[model samples]
Target: MLKIDTVFYNKLLKNFKINIKYAKIKTIHKVIIGRKGKK
Candidate 1:
């Protein structure tokens, strides 16, 4: 049971990390596209 819980926790952490990385990349993409119309 403990091992199962550990595996689940690790998977959750990995997914969280991936989401953060994706968000950062998306923000950078938006900046490059000049979404806000800034000069």
Candidate 2:
């Protein structure tokens, strides 16, 4: 149904956004820590 599809799509988009935000934060953390140091 259309409603179900919409809900699924919204969930997917929310997950994608979260993933992107996490990736960005991780990259920033790595940059701040430098390559030689342990995470």
* Alpha-carbon lDDT, every model: 0.95, 0.94
* lDDT (tens digit, per residue) of candidate 1 on 12-34: 99999999999999999999889
lDDT of model 2, residue 8: 100
Looking at model 2, residue 14 earns an lDDT score of 100
On residues 1-39, what C-alpha lDDT tens digit does candidate 2 reach at each position?
A: 999999999999999999999999999988888955755
Question: What would you estimate as the lDDT of candidate 2?
Answer: 0.94
Question: Can you give the lDDT of residue 27 in candidate 2?
Answer: 97
Q: What local lDDT score does residue 12 receive in model 1, on the 0 to 100 scale?
A: 100
Q: Which stretches of candidate 2 lie above 4 Å from their native place?
A: 35-39
